[model samples]
Target: MENRPDKTNKNNRTMKEKIRFYIILTLILVTGILIIQTILKPIPQGITGVQTLETGKQQSTQNSITGLGFLQPQDIHQIDTCIGDLSSTGAINPGDTVELKQDIYVGSTDCLNIDIANITLDCKHHKIIGNSSSSANGIVSNKTNDATVKGIIRNCHFYNFTNKTSIYTGKPIVLKEGAKYFLIHNNTFNVTRGITLNKTIDVTIANNTFANYSTLLTLYTDAEIYINGNLTNQTNETTIYNNTFEGIGISTNKPYAIYAIYANDLTIQGNTILTSNQITLDGVHDFYLKENALSRVEIKSQSSNTTAGRIERNTYIDTSTAMHFTSFSPNELSNISIYKHDMVNFSLSTMGSGVEQIKIYNNTFAGPMSIDLGSANNCTIWNNTFYPDEQTQITTGPNSKVRNNRIQNGIFKTITVTGDNTTVENNIFTKITGRGIVVKANNATVRNNTFNNITGIAIIIGDDTWQPPSHPVNVNGTTVYNNTIYLWVNLTTNTTMHSLLTGLPAIPGASTGIMIMPNTNNTNISENNINEQNIYAQTPPNMLKAETRGIFGKGINATYTLENLWIHDNTINTIREGITVENCQTTHIWNNNITKAGKTGIKTENCRGTRVNNNILEGGTYSPNIILWYKTGIEIFKSRAEIIQNNKIDKYHTGVYIYNATNTTSINSTINQTQIGIFSFLSMNNKILNSTITTRHIGINLLKTNHTQVNNSNIRNETGYLNTTGIQLSLSFY
Candidate 1:
């Protein structure tokens, strides 16, 4: 039974093999047919870089359709071929049409007539003097309002394009007002100054090569147009993308380039800008562009709602940052937008003035920080990259949100915020100068930052006030809170103002480490680390003030009125002036650690309503441990009313310089250190109650003042000169 089954299987295999052989034979026949047919067809060649007859070929052009295939060679003459004046045929008479059957040559500044280049035919309506060859333009239209010349002389073979003998004199097709619907295409030009036209009526110029143009094609902003498929090079932002750019330079030093001024809704897009100068635009509105390259660009201000202007997805690579803006005339436009761009390698060292708010986001700046914001405002700077060693990293000014950016390790300060109302958060300031953060303005929130191994001073506040105190940029409210600053002490050569106060002089009786800011009736500071190494800063001699000036209503002519300042709950380990307030009025300092402070915790002068309560002021020897120097702090040099209550003042040369006070009170406080705790002098109406005073010298002493009352208190540790009475009062008080 098995042998019979095997025989049947063999028969089945034979039948399958026979079918397979037949199918293979059929496939081979089909393949041969395709191969033979392909071989029989002729291949068309490309004409992109070729020229046909060098001289005139009295031949006829056989019109054929070879387009959309391998770009084929067309019959085009490369040399000049024209004799006798085509004009002498007849004075361009009315209704007379001039037509060339084959390609004609154009000469430099060649004239069709003494006055008019081409004939203004038959004083006619609907007259089109068609061009003969692929090139023909040496014509002009005069006394012609509505006219049309057709065909193209562009992207053609190279001919004598010297001495302005370009498609120069006029357009292979040019139109004037009332001249409607003109079509010009596919022309090549190499001229001193290329094609140009303006104040022309509706026209279309497409697929032309304005190459090696010492000065290329230009359509002054005045002309209304549709421009496409054109290649322009070596010029400013004059190559209008889709719309036409007014033809420029009729041979003048006046910069032979395109001008788009006072033009309404001239759309520009998909064009390349390769220039070192910025495009100058005035009175232009409703413009839009996408995916173009600009060396440097600028946008001026105009009437509000800078409407419908979008430069989206464009790439900018300015080597010199040559493009900038100035408000010679004011522009108050609304809706200006710049989004999704890649900008890199720019030398933006000179954008020096008037910049307005434009929505710029999702941009890449792999260059320097040259986009200065010294005078720009209300902007959104998000998702940008500032590569290391770039030139222009950060410029001046304020009210901007420059967050979520990655600016890598560089030699200088990566970003400097010198303006007001700016929020700098969630940014990585890595490998920067030890100086972590720098400020020259007021009313700012510096929070949640990472100063990665920055060797410079981490945090630097440019208050410029020392003894008394000075203001930041303006008298405005500012806050420095919740930041991790690491001040790295590197470069033994450059010493920093590690713990220094740059506010107004600590005016006796006033405040310190603070400013008299505007818009803020009072200032506020809280929850900060003063000893973080990232706070390693450098002393910029540029920030050095001229010299010293007096406090409020004193030698300073400016009226200083600071009321109700609150500074509380901050961890200040070591800083020059834990807090320095000068020539200010009314303050509150509560619950802060002045431990191991480089200077006094609270320093104020020429101020009033001063409350210094519940603070630990200690450990500052090289500097005054706790110095109330120069007529202020619980003392009235010029102002009055203060309560220095419940504080631990330790390790100070002179605890308090309570002098020139109109009214003062010190209650329930512990003073233990060298010299004295409460030293009063030249003050009035002073009262001390229920305080423990133990010092190396007389505990509570006074000098030259009035109404001094020292009540019952713990006074024991008298280490220095017991002969020095515990309570030394002036004769006036006695």
Candidate 2:
């Protein structure tokens, strides 16, 4: 009321105020509309929009995903979706690419069921986790019988998933029925069951990790990789390369790391598996498993075709049993080669039904090896090495060969031959506690083998009923030639050759350099050097025995006789008898040089039709424990129909002692420097013809004997003793 005098001026000022208020309101409305329009606008297609860029990430407009998700570089559709949304959307279309954005929490429902082909699902390093108690799977393919899904699934991380099915289902990633030509690579799986393939072909699994974790608690996680293919539809051309499997617990239900059945042309290369489970293969053919670090391998391939299988360049570490092979049925398995393996602590076992041409070469065993290849024909083991303080047992089958192997520091182990026509050649055995080689089969040849410091028998040719009662047949037609046996003796106790021969035993266990036992016939032992005189200078003795022989041809009893033995061209220097053949018939002992024989040399007792010719017996200091009757150059006791010809006997107590022998002839023989020459005791129909006998005491002696003749013989006794005679006959009729 005070300012009501100027109405026009007040009205004009009010109008100006109203105009300013309208302008402010209009500006606020325009700003709000602009903000709404900017927020509501759709992002452009074929472009990836990000508010902020990461360190190694770049803004791109080509709609392509990288890092194991590169299907087609240009036509790649990078779908930024979670793992749960892919399952909700049923099936990813063909030629579509889906990249997960966040970690997916899986429930009882399956995560991804791929039904279409040519799809790429990249998890992008996010974990697809299951509920701690759920029986859900991470990813599964189509279950149809004729659907072929060809796709690439890469860069996934799956954890805490457990399966409910009993038959290799509901795994972390499963390709089933007709899932073929797929690539699954660069995935990380933890605390979950691994991948499974059923009746698939041309699938490659590379650079994946299947590990066990302790954080999640679940059930029914059995095998790491299980591939099942039946007879009608077999899986083919599967490759698993450059993968790692760690801390995989063995399942008592189905304990295996990689189990395959009826698969062909498979390759498992460059893998590191650290578990106690087995890599079992059944009904597989034409495969290569190379360059792997494994624990165990069991093969039961039923392949009959001539295509080959190979397991090469593998390292087995810290396992009890490394490899086992069995059940190749119907026809023989063709050409399996196992070479270049390094076994830390393991055993290899094999059972042969239909297996042939199995070659094991260039391997090293750091511990003990128990190899039992049962009756496998044409098997070869060559160029292998066995380490110290370990035992090894190798049993060969028919037509098998063991060559060029170095087995050292063994504790009571041997290579046994059980089948026919086996050959053991060029092997080096050092510091062995048992027999170096045992022959129990027919036509087996042991040649060019060197035995050094063996505590037991160097080579034994016997039938069944030996220590190991598994041999079924008698040994026949066996030839052991060109073998060098050096028995070590104690150097500290042996100051002279006399002390070395008497004090310490050369061969331990009272064993011989070559022993031929009962039921062994048609044997040939030739060109062998037994118990070298200088063995003690090289190695010291570890043990002692009662006696040692160079070559012993033994028999069971008087009823069972060893027949048809030919022992020739052997050089034996031992502490006891050299070349003793007892209870034998139709035997030939010829051209042997017995040097440093402490007792009798070339002894034949209870034998018939024996021929000993061209033998050189050079005796040394007698054994203090042996009796006087046993210290002879050539002993023929209780034998008949014998022919001893062209033998050179020297430096013995008695040369040619014949006891209880009949129809024996010593023709063209020479005796030198002996105490008694041609001493015949209780012998009948014996003749010494064309013989030159020289003795220190008696030249020719006959005691309690009849029908003895000395024709064209030169007998000389050169001694100063009182009762020295050139020829003495006492209590005998001639």
Candidate 3:
């Protein structure tokens, strides 16, 4: 063109080379339309463009294809198999996090069959091993109505496995029904049967460590199980706190560590159970068993309606029976409360008839206890501290109240009241061998008690050879008041003072402070204070038997009749017969104050309308030479309409003694230093009026007499010896 710039600049250099060839053809057609728009853009749903090629082969690249692609070759061979490699059975979705590095030997039947929900099976502490061929379960979820399977199973280690198919089948972890919000924390179970919740809902099994399981935990009809901290076991609003159950009950025959059935609102607190036998509750409702360290506890209610049950502060060891309340129908077990326990080899049994309001308070017992309120009504056993070995019975409950108890070393009959309006008040019975308080029922009340070293009968009302005196089980209006009975007798035992001195058919020693036998009607032995010390009269291969007595009323073969009986204001000491009435009727031995009478100080036999009034007999006879074997200070036999008034007898062999008595009457009595003072035998229409007799031998003695009357008598002989007498008649009539 320069030649044409000469030529017109060579046509403008061919138009600047045709404008550089149309700008190189417009940058090659805009780089071929940006490589065909990056080859048609779109690839993302669980990712794919296939490129993982480090040698495990898979390459389809375009440049930005991130992972989990190639149609999931078994989820990329289980993410290259190693970290909790569960490759056989699947389906763990919705934000899954399955982490368990080793130990996993599930032999089928359910190693892990938790269907599909918001999963997280982090058994990071490994072990989910189980293989007993088929009836197995390591971690299961049946999913009944579908609570949408929510989950979290942490630090797991479940072992063994044996579910012989019956007895609710050996479980290792089963959440049935509508499985919801499950969180089984820090697990470590040595399974034979541990954890089973049927009908589940929002469960939380915390800090678990259940060993050698038989039934470490089981709850049928489950609702809200929130078991806290280490070891576990309960239902419908359950809360088991601080658990530690170590069982050897061999995995279920009847071996229960905790087996709650048909539960309602159960709460078991601070557990430390080492089981071999029982801890079962059937048809449980509103239960709260606190501070436990148990061996036995059974509460069975057949049809529900079990109300507010509470077993408090427990610590029972080596138990045969610590707690048992069984009901099959009726009201189905009502409100129960057992408080502050510390029992050892204890016993408590309540059966059927829908047990009512029960309250066993402040307990601390060691060894024997047999409390059976079979037909329980409003029961209350107060402030207990019993150390009974044998007869520790508190049976028959109605409006029961065994008050303020502290019974120690009891062998038999510590508290036996057949229960009508039962109230054994303020008790403190020590070292009893038998009978401290035995009221056969009927408005019962033995008040303010304190009996020490009792061998038998400190208070025994009615038992005329065991109740059936012509169909009269009457211990009517029974009340033995203000008691304080002490029978030392040098701690008693010539075989128990010869069995209280030869007891059988009548008495050698039935050891009585208060013993009202027969039908015992309107009975009331008032203000008692009996103290018997070293009462001696024992020639026991035969003889020496004067019916050892101290306030005793007998009538066994006479077809029972001890009516309107009231022995009043008693203070008897060193006795061997001080107030003894036989077939009593309208009997009232009044204002008693007798001391050291080893034989008789108010004795009546075959009594009629008897009354020995204003008594004050002192230091009489201990069988002084046994003549007619008379050791008397007012003794009447075959009595009828008898009344010995204003008595004051001192140092006697015989004073006011009547035999075969008929219309007997000894008025205004005062006899002192007597061998015999006003003594009538074979008496018919007797009367010793205004008596003031003093004698060492005989002041007024009548033998084999009839129609006797010694009027306005004041006879004294002060024993000048050699047949001394102021008036002595033999085989005569006056």
Q: In model 1, which range of ten residues has the least summed lDDT?
A: 542-551
Residue-wise C-alpha lDDT for candidate 3, range 145-232, written one tens digit per residue: 6656666666777776644444334356777766666666667777656677665655655556666644333332111121111112
Better model by lDDT: candidate 2 vs candidate 3: 2
Clashes of 2: 0
Candidate 2, residue 35: the lDDT equals: 97
lDDT of 1 by residue, 1-734 (tens): 75998899999999999999999999999999989988985543542212233222233221111221111122332222332233233323221233332355544433232122212111111112223232444433322443432212222322233323333233333333232232234444433223433333333444444333334234332112211111121111122443222222332233222334443454456544444323444344566656756554554543222334666776664456533444433544334566776766643321223345545566666645455556566555567666655333564456766677666655544555666787777666665642344555666666666555444344444433323444434335656566544333343333333223322332221111222332234456666544424222112221111111111111122254455667777666533345555455567878877654333445656677878788777744423342323211223344468788887777655556576776777888787664666777777787888878776667777777678788877776655446444776656664
lDDT of model 2 at residue 416? Answer: 88
Give every collision pair in model 2: none
Q: How far is candidate 1 from the true structure (C-alpha RMSD, Å)?
A: 14.2
Model 1 clash number: 101
The weakest ten consecutive residues by lDDT in model 2 span 49-58
Q: Which candidate is the best by TM-score?
A: 2
lDDT of 3 at 484: 85
Residue 185 miss distance in model 3 (angstroms): 11
